[model samples]
Target chain A: MLKELDPLLHSQLRLGVMSLLMSLESADFTFLKEKTNSTAGNLSVQIDKLSEAGYIEVIKSFRDKKPLTTCKITKKGIKAFEQYVEVLKQYIK
Target chain B: MNDEKNLTPQESLEVITSMIRQAKGNMKKSSFYFLLWGWTIVLANLCVFILIKFTTITNPFLVFGLTIPAAIISVVYGIRQGKQITAPTMLDNINRWQWTGFGFTCFIFAFFGQRIGWQINPVIITMCAAPTFLTGIMLRFKPLILGGIVFWVMGILSFLAPVSWQFLLASFAVTFGYLVPGYMLKKTEA
Candidate 1:
């Protein structure tokens, strides 16, 4: 029997954000927006959702007197992503 | 990028691969640090070689003082580049620490290698190989890996050569280990 996909990481934007975060040490809001080709409003909402799920950590700090939001994948997020990929591979096979 | 109800496994795999590729793409820009140090060290090595061979100067090592300016330039350039980066990736962290450690090793060698009566050339070249080799492995760049190997081999050989010829060997070592790979990195950026 096939396992269910990770609901938090199954959607388009959230998955993109998680995948990007997985590869990086930490990424800020602007970088994520640029890479995902996402608008700030939509990206903020998805980031919030992921943050709420405890799949990622969001840190807000000031850089050069400007606010910066940096996102990094949590350990929970890494486990989720790995399981998601394992299930994905099964379906692909 | 549009929101969808459910993504197929293939689409999910594609997303992961595509985003990873995009992240890696950001690292394509050349830092030019290698090129700067390559030329500076090459010049210093040759200057020392020439002074010892031709001039009546008692201290040929004075020419190495030129590296002060080189170090300043590297610091300024590094700060400028750091400001432009939006985020640090894993590879970036690794590369930064690798070079930092290498820099510390060089500093130690510069200050103590002479006091211990150790030949500085072989030690310098051998210590320099660590960062270059690690960087090549991380970036999957073959030229740098080979260059690192060249440095190691030449560094060992430097011990066997005559003292005067050791300077020439140092020159050759940096030319291949740094200059060649430095230019190759620039070419990849282009």
Candidate 2:
């Protein structure tokens, strides 16, 4: 079961985004981008994938008519991260 | 919390960023505490030497208690001058190393000091200081500062035990024990 999650989470940028978000309740797009070294277009696609999977909640709002995206990890995301670690441990073992 | 319901995504991002900057500032301030404690220790020892030379006073612990409050005030005041760190560095590791060194020094001081013309001071130095430094590093917290306070109070009480050179012990108690730990705390946080 954990094997299913291993590949999805191993992506570098998404991994960085998830790890950073794990430490925080939520994070802005800029923080996620800067930390993960991802371009805007690339991040948007990854975020959408994770959102579609129910792993993250994306909130959008406008300040001065500008769009912003904030990411938050969902319960499913936490479970995935935990299961991902458990599965990864087998590889090292 | 529901205030976000009406605002645009840009406003939400701005609000969260502002929160992050404020939290970052507080954490940065906590890290420089070790630098302040280290300087305070060095200065206190120097002051002790100066006091012993001029006054007929044999015990320096009283002066030590005075010096501590000063250290506290200075730590809070020194916030203005301390460097602000927003990123991680090897310096964070250095913080842990310093406290470990202080713990070892205290243990070594205690072992030897307990054997010979050993005054009560070295023992107090080991007891109060070694743990304080070690705890700060282990916990990586600033508010763990309460440990230093507890150590200081114990050092003062150790003097009333009818021990000779209790004054020497009390002063070293705060200097070697609590202060070293206090200093290491800021470094360990990164």
TM-score for all models, in order of appearance: 0.89, 0.40
User: Backbone clashes per model, in order?
Assistant: 0, 9
Candidate 1: misplaced stretches above 4 Å? A62-66, A90-93, B28-31
Candidate 2 chain A — worst ten consecutive residues by lDDT sum?
A1-10
lDDT of 1 by residue, A2-91 (tens): 988888899888999998998898898999999998889989999999999999999998888898899999999999999999988899
Q: Write down the TM-score for model 1.
A: 0.89
Q: Lowest summed lDDT over 10 consecutive residues: which window, candidate 2 chain B? A: B1-10
True contacts kept of each: 0.79, 0.00
